[model samples]
Target: MKSWGLLLVAALALSGSYAVDRNNFKTCDQSGFCKRLRGFKPEKSEYSLNLDTVLVHGNVLSAEVDTVDTTAQERKVLWHYAMRLSALVDGTFRVEIDEVDPLYPRYRTQLALDGEPKADGLKLLSNENGKLTLMNSQGHKVVIRATPLKIEFLNKAGDVAVVLNDNAQLVVEPLRVKKERIDDEDGNAVEVVSPLLCLYCFCDWILKCRQVFVFSALTAT
Candidate 1:
């Protein structure tokens, strides 16, 4: 009975009889974050790993990443992130980044992996001047560049195997409170009305006025 029920469900699913709301879906262009990141074309990355905060523990090397704000008079930190580089088993390197202190908890998918990843113990080769090098159990080197914030994996022969953030498109939109408009002179809260909303309000007022005028005309008769 259970097998028959399972087959029936599978057949219904494969038949594509389910009602899907396509209007709820959005493309990359429709999403603000996606469009902003996709349109960004920077000569070099504005984010860098703060070498002063680099810490190595067991098989993980973690550091604080700061986005440089050049809009101000002098260089300043705009946003901060906690980055972790783990040298997993079989020469696979895993990079994880998250907001240092977020307003809301961000969802991270743990279902992609079958189980917790096993990391190999990292052997620190050099940590000086803006570069940190570590070797994994498989003799692969992980080079961390601090100035522009780049991670490179090199094989035993010193050939570059993989590189991260090479295109300089690393952007982390920090979670912040939505700023409300305010009256500058009075220092009171101001409501922001969109064009569409204004149009709707005007149409509603006109509709009510027309109804009142029609009622008055009828009463005058």
Candidate 2:
């Protein structure tokens, strides 16, 4: 998930003084979703945009999100999703993606942003290629790459700051309800890989590691 990159950038930007317990973190491959995502080859992204679902409201834009496939072909149930991108006047940008109407409510991140983004330095510009681009006079840009579904954030120097599908790894977890019947476990197991869950796993590992390290240090002293 892009949150991994955001966490790194936030740590670097806010305060680089804290010591990190790298051992507490799993290599991306350890994550089930990460593993599946990386398993997708370089140019083979399963996701595609539905242009007819596009909506533009002032500084905000949104569209439907979709993905392909299932084996044993008779079963038919398409995952539903929606994506929203907003450019606040404050030169900042935000992206929200979730299931359009979930059978079960999914986890929405509790991480609070620093209030409403200031309404400056932000420009909503559409390109000839139809990808929406948000430019910041202060040097930040968010590019919505529709095909194969990638979203890239660029720094003022034009280097990638954070990317959602950098390795074709932007997998979405749609909201699903637990089945009371037998034989659905396999299907369920493969479906609910939430990005919020990944963020939780990452954060929990960091906090627990930090606490343990601090306790051990104090006891040793």
What Cα-based lDDT does every candidate model obtain? 0.66, 0.54
Clash pairs, candidate 2, are 89-118, 89-119, 89-120, 90-118, 90-119, 90-120
- Who wins the TM-score comparison? 1
- TM-score for candidate 2, please give it: 0.51
List model 1 lDDT by residue over 2-71, tens digit each. Answer: 9999999999897775566668889898865666567654543377899889888999888999877655
Model 1 global lDDT (CA atoms, 0 to 1): 0.66
Model 1 earns a TM-score of 0.63
TM-score per prediction, in order, is 0.63, 0.51
**Candidate 1 residue runs with Cα over 4 Å from true position:** 1-30, 38-45, 176-221
For all the candidates, what are their Cα RMSDs to the real structure? Answer: 22.4, 16.4
Residue lDDT tens for model 2, 176-208: 333333335465534333323231111112222
